[model samples]
Target: MNSVSYDAAQRITLGMKASDCRFIMDEWLHRDAPCTLTVRRAKTKGLLCVVADINPNENPDGLYFLSWCVQHLNSRVKVDIKRL
Candidate 1:
């Protein structure tokens, strides 16, 4: 599994709307395999965790789109990609 974690610069909402997740799953990542988005509160900031079965190195464009989608939602957020 591969995961990307986003840490927000400023405090924001703790969770993403279901509609937004649906948009990402059904619209943005529709071509590739499905993924999971998990949102949590980190102290005063927000954290978004994206987990997918695909390896990011093998699909840079998909990763880019995923990152873009997250950033589009919250510009203040920065991403940290991880492989597991």
Candidate 2:
């Protein structure tokens, strides 16, 4: 399985506030947090991931969006690619 590197993870972030997300990543990377990468399959929708932190109290469209960091993301690549 292929996984996302720290460099790439640094580039990927979620939430409207980049600073907030950056802070979270920084904590995980620098502070040695037990950050985990996770992935969820959405039946026919392919996949669903919380790439950012939204208002959990205020469920927009009846969907509660909580804050998510790279820790909760799946770095492994589960797809097959062909060279052109």
> Roughly what TM-score does model 2 have, to 2 decimal places?
0.25
Segments of candidate 1 deviating more than 4 angstroms: 1-15, 29-50, 75-81
* Model 2 alpha-carbon drift over 4 Å, by segment: 1-16, 37-84
What is the lDDT, from 0 to 100, of the residue 40 in candidate 1? 47
Q: How far is candidate 1 from the true structure (C-alpha RMSD, Å)?
A: 8.5
Per-residue CA lDDT of model 2 for 1-84, tens digit only, reads 432232222212222233434454565556443334223332434333213222223323111111233334333212221111
For all predicted structures, in order, the TM-scores are: 0.42, 0.25
Pairs that collide in candidate 1 are none
Per-candidate Cα RMSD to the true structure, in Å, reads: 8.5, 14.8
Candidate closest to the true structure, highest TM-score: 1
Error of 1 at 16 (Å): 2.8
